[model samples]
Target: GGWPDAVTGSKKNALRRAIQYVETIIQTDISSVDNIRKDPVKVRDLMLSLARNTATVATVKTIRDDMVRGDADNALSAPTIYGYLNALERMFVVEDLPAWSPSLRSKTTIRTSPKRHFVDPSIATAVMRLTPGRLLKDFLFFGFLFESLCIRDLRIYADGNDGQVFHYRDANGLEADAVVVLNDGRWGAVEVKLGTKEIEEAAIHLRKLKERINTEKMMEPSFLLILTAGTYAYRREDGVLVVPLACLKD
Candidate 1:
C-alpha cells in the first residue's frame, strides 16, 4: 500500500522530528531505567526532584546524568524534557497539575503558580533517576509531590460534578493545598502527606479556612481530607477523611 499524501507532507516532518527527540533520550545508556521500574523509592525521588525544580523540566539524558551526580547540572534541554513529560502525561504516566482559584468575588484574580505532578509514581522515578534506597532520606520532598499528584487526580475526578479545584492561601500565610466544592456549595478540603501519620496539621488548616470564611454564610458541611501513601482509607476521629492516593483517581 502507498503512503497517504497527507502523511507524506507536514505531518510526516512533524512525526520525524518527534521520533528523533524520543530516540535521542531512549537510545542513551542509563542503568537507572531498570531501577526506576523496580523501586518505589527511586520513583518518589524523581518526582520530588522535579517538584523542587519547578522552574524548569529536564530532558531524559540530563535527568539521567543528574540522578548520578545528585544535582541538575546535566539537566535536559527544556523543550526536549517538556515534550517527554507531555508524552508521559498522555499515556497517564505523569500529570502536571495546574493551580486554580475561583471567581467568588472578582473574575480578575487568579493564582500565579501552577504545580506539576506525575500520575504514576514509577514514571516520576524514571524521569528523576532515583533508586529505592534514596527515598527514606527524601521523604518530605516526596510528601509534597505526592500531595500535588493526589490533588491533580482529585481535580480530574471532580470534573462535571459542580466542584472546582482551588488552593487556599491567605495574607497571613494559612494555606490548604486543595479544596473541592459540591454543586450545592458544600466544600471539602485536602492536605497531602507521605505517610498515614500526622493528620492533625491538615485539620488545623481546615479550621483556619472555616474561620477565614464565615461558615454560616459561605461554607457548607466541610470535610478535611488527608491523602496518605498508605493502602487504606478511613475517617479519623476528628471527622477528617484519611484517604489513600490511589482512591482519588477518576
Candidate 2:
C-alpha cells in the first residue's frame, strides 16, 4: 500500500514521475548551495543501496565503494561523495541514527559509525524499484525494510516526547535497533522484529544492553520495547512490551 505497491507498470510510472519532481527540487537546492557539485546519478545510486539494505552503519568509504560498483565509469572521489551525502541529508532525503554510548559498567568499546536510513521507507523502495511480490519472495531484505519503517515511526514518536532516536552496538556485538532519549536523560531501548521467531533474540539483546549500562551515570531506561509486524501485542513477563507496528502512535 506504500512504496512496494508503487513498483509496478503504472504505479512505477507514477513513482518515476514523482521522482522527477523531487529531482528538480534537489537540483534547484544544489544550485543555490553553490559549493556542492550536483551529481544526480551518484545520489540516486546511494538511495538504491539505502533501500536494498536495512539500516547499515555506513562510512564514507563504504558508500564510495558502492557508488563505484554501481557505475565504475563515473565513480566519485571520496570527498565529492561526502559532499553529496551531506547535501542529501540537508535536504531531508536521508537521516542517521547516531550510536548510543552510555557509561558502561564493563569496558566494552562501542561502534561509533551512524546507521543510515531514508527519512521515509518509501524513498528506498522507489529508488530500488522493489515491488510487493518481489519483497515477499525476499523475506530477509523485507525484514530490513520493516526495521527502517519502524525507525521512521520511532523518530516521529520520540520527537513528540522531546527526544531523539538512536541505535546501539558494542564491541562484544550486542545491539539494539533503536534507542529513544529525552533531554532530561531518561531513555528507552527498542528492537524491531519482523517475525515472532526473532523476538527472543531481540529481547536478549535489550536485556544485555540494560545490564551493561552504568545506571549511576545515566538513568535506567524508561522502558524496553519489541516492535513487530505481526498481529498481536502484549507485554512479556520481564516487562518488555511487544507491540505491533500498526498499534504504535506518537
Each prediction's TM-score versus the true structure = 0.55, 0.88
Task: Give the best candidate by TM-score.
Answer: 2
Query: Best-fitting candidate, measured by lDDT?
Result: 2
- Give the true-structure RMSD of model 2: 3.4
Per-residue lDDT tens digits for candidate 1, residues 133-221, read 66556976566556655665676677768676766654455667777877787787777777645777777777665555644556644
Residue 63's lDDT within candidate 1 is 51
Give candidate 1's TM-score: 0.55
Tens digits of per-residue lDDT, candidate 2, 178-245, equal 99999999999999998999899898988999999899899988999999988888999998999999
Model 2 segments beyond 4 Å from truth? 1-37, 70-73
lDDT of residue 34 for candidate 2 = 48
Q: What is the C-alpha RMSD of each candidate to the true structure, in Å?
A: 12.3, 3.4
